[model samples]
Target: MSLPTLHDLHRPLGSTGLTVSPLGLGTVKLGRDQGVKYPNGFTIPDDQQALQLLAQARELGINLIDTAPAYGRSEERLGPLLRGQRHEWVIVSKVGEEFDNGQSRFDFSAAHTRLSVERSLKRLETDCIELVLVHSDGNDLHILEHEDVYATLERLKQEGKIRGFGFSGKTAAGGVKALEQGDCAMVTYNLNEQGERPVLDYAADHGKAILVKKALASGHVCLSPGVDPVRASFELLFAHPGVSSAIVGTINPVHLAHNVATVAQVLKQR
Candidate 1:
């Protein structure tokens, strides 16, 4: 029998009028290799390799693609790679953080936020991004309550440059606060970390989308020998009804397929 794919498991991304696959293809490895926290080092995929991976992802029924300015050349490469298939995916990009010269910097000023979104649009070759998130610098509460980034994102949504806006935050309080004014919150949820469980709970109760980042603990899952880490991770994530999708960044086609199959099995069991 053929393995199940995510195509059949698409669901609503909160009330944003967008439906997303349970697994989102994260494209960081397509653009940058330095400063990443993956357990294993990997060479950035070439144009042909990247194209094939993207094609395989679509065939496996993934519709959400996550990218960010912090991910080096990810946004720019995706522009040409996804040229004609724009409507086929739900694009999630971010503002506030920028990676340059092998270092990271953040800008949450109103002017910088607007500039970042426009630059991402040009780089991604899209007129409007589906979701734009404020990439936090670990100071989630300050960014949400003090910075102009969230408010700027709200304006961008109204101006039709983005369909929805939210926060990729580090704390549960920040996640809940972000959802109070946004459509989604990308939080760290996996077998190793459950501190953000309250964020998932808030999303479930308030009708907000929760996208799981580091779903496999950034490739450092240290579980029991016989316990399948990927399976265990998805089991934890999908058990929560508020999780819209888990963003997994894998450049290897084999890993991608395995992840999809594992998630399919877990969702079926659920």
Candidate 2:
């Protein structure tokens, strides 16, 4: 039998009317190397290398590309690299957070939110982003309730600047609140951490989308001996019917292919 690719497992992104692959390609490593939590140090891939990696990902059936304004030059690089192939991928970006000089800052006021979305569109060279999440500063509930970010995202959706909007929240309550007013929530879920499982349950019950971040625990899952960490991670994620897709940030082509194959295997068994 032929090995399955992510293309074979494309599914609905909540009610946004977009179909996305089961594994999303995260571009953090493609841009920034500072303040990252990965286990080892690495150099950023040049444009040629980055393009080759993207081509490999596409050939392996990945169509969801996750980027963010806080991910260094990620959005800017993707603009030109992904030019002329805009329709081929589902792009997910974020607002409310900015990274500069190896530091991070956030702005969630209505004015900043609107400016962020417009800047993202310009950097991405696209008229509309498929999904935009508010990058939380670990103050999920506070940002959800007091900040104008979510409200502005809703306005952006109505203005046709974004297809869907949600929060990359740090708390279950915030995730639930986000879905109550938005289309999806990016939550942290993996073997080491299940604190956000409630968010997944909520999404399953409510027909909202849940995109998982740090599914491999930021590449820290391989510490256990004799355990297939990749397989283990995917099993834990796919077992939850609410998980729309897991964003895996890997720049190495071999690792990317392995992760996809493992995800394909785990989903097939499900």
Measured by lDDT, the strongest candidate is 1
Cα lDDT, model 1, residue 99: 93
Instruction: Note the residue pairs that clash in candidate 2.
Output: none
Each prediction's Cα RMSD? Answer: 0.8, 1.1
Q: How close is candidate 2 to the true structure, as a TM-score?
A: 0.98
For model 1, residues 83-201, the per-residue Cα lDDT tens digits are 89999999999999999999999999999999999999999999999999999999999998888999899999999999999999899999999999999999999988889999999
User: Global CA lDDT of candidate 2, please?
Assistant: 0.93
lDDT of 2 at 217: 96
Candidate 1 similarity to native, TM-score: 0.99
The number of the candidate with the highest TM-score is: 1
Clashes of 1: 0
**Model 1 worst lDDT run, 10 consecutive residues:** 1-10
lDDT of 2 by residue, 97-154 (tens): 9999999999999999999999999999999999999999989989988988988999
| lDDT to native, each model | 0.94, 0.93
